[model samples]
Target chain A: MSELLKIENLHVSVGDKELLHGINLTVEKGKVHVIMGVNGAGKSTLMHAIMGNPAYKITKGRILFEGQDITELSVDKRAKLGIFLSFQSPVAVAGITMENFIRTTKTTVSGQQQKVFAFKKLLKERMNNLSMDASYAERYLNDGFSGGERKKSEILQLRLLEPKLALLDETDSGLDVDAVRIVSKNISEYHNENNSILLITHLNQILQLIKPDVVHILIDGQIVREGGAELADEVEQNGFDAYRLAVKGDGNDEA
Target chain B: MKEIAINRLPVLTYRYLKTNDTKILFSAPQVSAAADFSDKTYVTVGAEFPENFEGASSETLAAALAGEKYTITIPSGMQAKLTIEIKLENQHADYAGAYHFLLQKGAKLELVWKLSGTEAAQGSYLASYYELEDAAELKISKLQADLAEATLYDQRFFKLGKAAKADVASAELGGKQVIVHSRGALNGDEAALTERTVYTGTGKQHLDLFYHIDHWGKKTVSLIDGKGALAGEAKKIFRSTLDFHRGCAGSEGEEGDYAIQLSPKAKNISLPLLLCTEDNVAGNHASSAGQVSEEDVYYLMSRGFSWEEARRIIVESLMRPIVDSLETSLQEETLEEIRRKLDAKGE
Candidate 1:
């Protein structure tokens, strides 16, 4: 497999506080990478940094997408280059309907004007797959959606945009059993030999459906351990306490 | 040319702020043309103005400058649909017209009005009055999209009788300087009035809008909603009042003004007022003005829209409710004008 994304000693900060400490990771084409951590372990910080979120400043290190440095690119520019981040908490933007928003975004990213009728038909089909009601197409984007519905809406964008690299931040956090199954199935279908996915989650429930090729244990803004899928099972069986202690022990030794 | 003070607030404020009233240099136009109506059966060429016709603006000035008048009377228990178009053709042209509508008891009317003009047309003054008897209903969709160089002065009055109701949706999208004065009086028990206005101002355009609704009978209801956006060096002042007079027990009134400022230099001033003279009445007023949300912009940008495109989309969204309320043809035309003004720079 070829490398799709490579982060070299990435250091990220928010305001005056550094959230990511010299992190290094790589995602290969056709592979699913998972980062599991407790809350405040900087999982979201890493994903945002990869997507060029201005709020997450990269104080040091560089991010390369398909070997092209994107450390200085704006969010829109990075998006145009086929990097997508499904927000943990999507904002509700009233006035623009879901159909119009998706069509506009797709047109901008695909560099083509979409026909209204064709786009509507395509949107309807995709929405049906997600079990979203047809009326949601005309409703304002996530204006009054329930939590599970919002997650499905995010995945709908993920399937439609079809970006080369997708960073989903806890897409399965708030879903129930059935919704989780459906969302996982859709995500599994979206992944193929030509693309990659980097998923961030604290729960192992989602892992039961979509297996991760690699799992990294993150603690105190650093990766404490890296292994195959069994690492997630081990963490689920025990907890992150052992990983947190190991990082703390390492810090004590350094001190 | 003469000078007159118009659009005075019902309650006085500090005089230096200029929110109390506006003074404009006015000249009566040479052209006098009647509005084009879709159906002529219920229309008459000339009609006597109502004895108690009161507008938000100076009623005397509106009466003195009026050049043409058309009246439409809907029969009792009947339903009617009407489309009226007022177009000014000449450069530097001026026009003033009066329109009167009478709906008998249990009558219903759906009216759509379109006002347009040439690129360099000077001024247009329109005064419209509606009188609805017991249990009558009226629905109005008004679109004002004249050229950017023109000036517009619109005055509307509504007198609703027992159990009557009126719904008005107005879209003001053009003109160098636009002034709107709308007033409604609910004189009968259970009468209701709902007026929603949406506007967009670009370049150096100025918009002065005032709306006042009086609840005089028991259980009367009134709602006034104003939403708009401002760009460039444009400025807008929105004043709305909901007054619940004595003997209007169980009446409820609500008014709100929400605005989005698109440019740094754009100005938005909103004043929402509620007055109650009866102890059993309910009234609420709210006003809010702010810039576009940074988070919303960032979210749109993540979808590959530039900063400018993101702002435009958000503004369009804010204006969508009113734009969608227009007729299909007018909807497209109004959207085109919005896009043009948004794309233009330093106009």
Candidate 2:
């Protein structure tokens, strides 16, 4: 499979504090890479850093997307390059309707003549898949949406944009069991249809629905261990105690 | 200094006034005021009233009509709508004046004004007295302006015999220095009043909006909604008072909320005052001013919009609901004008 993204020696800081220290990771096309760690393990920070959030400054690193160095690109430019990040907590945007926002996003990304009827039909189909009310497509984007609905809207965007590298940043957070199953189904469908996914999640319940090809244990801003999908089940059953021991035995290489 | 001819007579002038202020004011003098296609009137009032700022209505009318005069009358039981267009393109010339509208018993009136840019120290006053018999309605809207210094002082007194309604809306978008004062009075039972005000300021602009409502009747209802936005070094202060007299039993006065969007280096203050002398009346007020938030920006950006685009969209949407309430033609015109100003600001 072709490689979609490669991050080497990624060092990042939020304000004055460093969040990611000498991080490295790679995701290939048509693969699911699960990033799992305890709380404050910098999973969300790594995703934001990769997506070029201005708040997360990269002090030392290189990010290659589709064989092109994009570490210096702005978030919009990165988005145009087909790099998408589903926010952990999707923010509410008032006034702009969902239809308008989605249409504009598609125009920016694809620039193709949109068939209104066909687009609406497809939106309706995907929304049904995510159990979103049809009227949500007309309502303001994420305004007054329930927690589950907001996450569903994020997945809806992913299904619409079809980005090359989809970074699902805790898309499973704040979702009920039913919502998680539906979102997991949509994520799996996305993997089968197009693009790779780097899901940064703490819950293995969603992992059971959409199996990960590889599971990487991240601790204190560094990947302490890398293994197969079994690694996720092992950590889920045994917790990260052994991994934390391994990270500590290394004499804290980051220090 | 130059000498110009007016009404076939030469007049001495310094620098030059870029606007026909007389013609603009004459076009809309009162509720039924209309431009006289056959006869034109000129009036000008020039007296510095910085301290107490009070002058006679007749004296202010005479200055603008020194060259010519026209009259507009709203008769009993008659309701009329007036549209006035004022355009100014000069500087260094100070324009001052007042216009009067006398509404007879049972009369109703609606007035709308569209103002363009003008030079420094221009002042305006509009006084309307409703001599109502029993039931009457008056609706008014004073819209946009681009001026160096302007004051729109509107004094309205409604003589309510039994039941009357007053609807007042003032929407001002651009100007250098503007002060708008609106006073509404209800003296009859079962009377209703609604007032809506919106203003936007940029650059070194300063705007002051004061609204005073006095209720004297039982079972009176009043509603007020005000909104504002400021950019650059602009500053705005809005003061609103909802007053219920002692004998005004069961009267309800609701203060409108104002939201101000401040760009860098902008300042804003809003004071909504609720005063009640009667124990049975209901009165309340709320106001706020703040900048854009990171989360709002992020929500837009994540969906493929630039920060600038997101900010513009939010601000435009903030006023869209109000603009939608206007007539279709007026809404389109205002939207077009706002677009032009936004483009001028390089947004």
lDDT of 2: 0.69
For candidate 2, write residues B1-347 as lDDT tens digits.
12221111012123353211111122222222222221122212222212222222333333333322223346777777766555444432333333444456677766665655565435444433444455776666656655645534333444454577766666676566554555566788878877777667777776666666778989988877776567777877666778899999999888865554656678776667787889998888888777766666665666567777766666666666566545344676666655555445621
- Runs of candidate 1 exceeding 4 Å displacement: A112-122, A245-255, B1-4, B13-18, B23-34, B63-65, B246-252, B278-284
Residue pairs in collision within model 2: B42-B64, B42-B65, B43-B63, B43-B64, B43-B65, B44-B63, B44-B64
Chain B TM for prediction 2: 0.72
Q: After superposition, how far is residue B216 of candidate 1 from its true place, in Å?
A: 3.1
What is the i-RMS of every prediction? Answer: 1.1, 1.9
DockQ of each: 0.69, 0.38
Model 1 is docked with a DockQ of: 0.69
TM-score, B chain alone, candidates in order: 0.94, 0.72
Report the Cα lDDT for residue A27, model 2: 88
Which 10-residue window in model 1 chain A sums to the lowest lDDT?
Answer: A246-255
lDDT of 1 at A161: 89
Clashes of 1: 0
For model 2, the DockQ equals: 0.38
